[model samples]
Target: METFSIHPIGYVRERDGSKVLEVLPEYRPALDKLDEWGHVVSVWWFSGSDNPDTRSILRQTRPHQSSPGEAGTFATRSPRRPNPLGLTVAKIDRVDVEQGLVVIDRHDALPDTPLLDIKPYSPGSDRVEAPILPEWAAHWPKSREESAVFDWAKEDGKA
Candidate 1:
């Protein structure tokens, strides 16, 4: 198998209770004009879950109530995969180019999580007009804004 290397360009931070992505001094230049986009796609590492055992978990039962009883790792967004990477599309609240800080509305990453990369969220390519979902998840929210208020715990039968 071919191997690849990945180095974090920055780290996620918590500033005054707000989530922020602080790019390293060397990568700050990449943030140039990023503010023009209203949202960004953050690629981060699942640092805490990266391990031999986790990486070996290829199947999960009841990963989510809306999912099948058992599913392959690729079928669900389990952090325990061949590659422990996480992707999140976050709404940009603010961006400070000089400081290389990006304040986002929310992210499913832990503070200090290693940030792999950031790309402007282009709707033309990122948004799907009609996405096919299993019957179980057909009732889920249709938009990110709606998802913010959606009761995922309830949908997962954990509420």
Candidate 2:
């Protein structure tokens, strides 16, 4: 198998440290004009799951309690998939270009999550007027704003 290398441009600091995307000093210049947009699509790596065993996991039993049962890695957003990569569209609250810090709304990623890339969210292309989802998840919040009060733990079978 061919191997590839990926270097993170920054890290996601949350909770105790600071809920922000701290761009490395060398990558600070890349944050220019990021504040112009209200949101950004962040590509991050699930570093904690970066292991052979986790990557080899191809199926999981009901990642979501609302789900019917077992699902293939691609069927569910399980961190134990072949690639422990995370993609989220985060709401940009503030951007400090000088300090290379970007404050975003709640994200599933943990503190120190390796940031792969950041792209400005364009509603014209990113938003789908009619998206098809499984029956279990069809009742999810229609927009990110509506998700603020959602009980996520309940959906994950944690509550």
Clashes of each: 0, 0
Position 120, candidate 1: lDDT: 97
- What lDDT would each prediction earn against the true structure? 0.91, 0.87
TM-score of each: 0.95, 0.91
Q: In candidate 1, which residue pairs get closer than 3 Å at backbone N, Cα or C atoms, i.e. clash?
A: none
Q: Candidate 1 has what TM-score?
A: 0.95
Task: Write the residue-wise lDDT of candidate 1 on 1-159 in tens digits.
Answer: 999999999998899999999999999989989999999999999999999999999997777776778889998888989899999999999999889999999998999999999999999999999999878789988999999999888765332
Q: Please provide, for model 2 over 116-146, each residue's C-alpha lDDT reduced to its tens digit, 9 standing for 90 to 100.
A: 8989999999999998999999988888788
Off by over 4 Å in 1: 157-159
Could you tell me how far off, in angstroms, the CA of residue 156 lies in candidate 2 after the best superposition?
A: 1.6
lDDT score, candidate 1: 0.91
